[model samples]
Target: MQTLLKPSFTRETAFLKVKAAEDAWNRRSAILNQTLNTKMVRV
Candidate 1:
């Protein structure tokens, strides 16, 4: 979005932000999946 418009804007910090966001999302999804699996096993 904004990054596409501002091609020169995404260098180091922007890259780090995007990477951190992606990693956080993946971790969150993995945690949720694990919780669901644990609940299923308990049942």
Candidate 2:
């Protein structure tokens, strides 16, 4: 909720938030892909 209630004060802040989210998502997908590959290798 804080994000819902408070608007970003600058374009830079919004851009930073978007970039961080994208980075985190990319990292998560990469980790998941790696785990899946490892499991497949073991099988």
Candidate 3:
């Protein structure tokens, strides 16, 4: 399981955590867009 970033985290750790979250969000968005496009094309 991913460790939760707490207030005691170092600056570098905090930055890495933020970057990871952004990457995850982008990935999910891409998947959602692809699914929507495919459904739209079929309609």
Candidate closest to the true structure, highest TM-score: 3
**What are the per-residue Cα lDDT tens digits for candidate 1 across 1-43?**
3544556555898899899999999999987777533755453
All-Cα superposition RMSD per candidate: 7.5, 7.9, 9.1
Could you give candidate 3's per-residue lDDT for residues 4-43 as a string of tens digits?
7768888999999999999999999988778533755454
Residue 23: error of model 2 in Å? 0.3
Clashing pairs in 2: none
List the global CA lDDT of all models: 0.78, 0.79, 0.86
For each candidate, how many residue pairs have backbone atoms clashing (under 3 Å)?
A: 0, 0, 0
**25 Cα displacement, candidate 3 (Å):** 0.4
Between prediction 2 and prediction 3, which has the larger TM-score? 3
TM-score of 2: 0.56
- Name model 2 segments beyond 4 Å from true: 1-6, 36-43
> What is the TM-score of each predicted model, taking all chains together?
0.52, 0.56, 0.60
Evaluate candidate 1 by giving its C-alpha RMSD to the native, one decimal.
Answer: 7.5
**Candidate 2 least-lDDT 10 residues:** 34-43
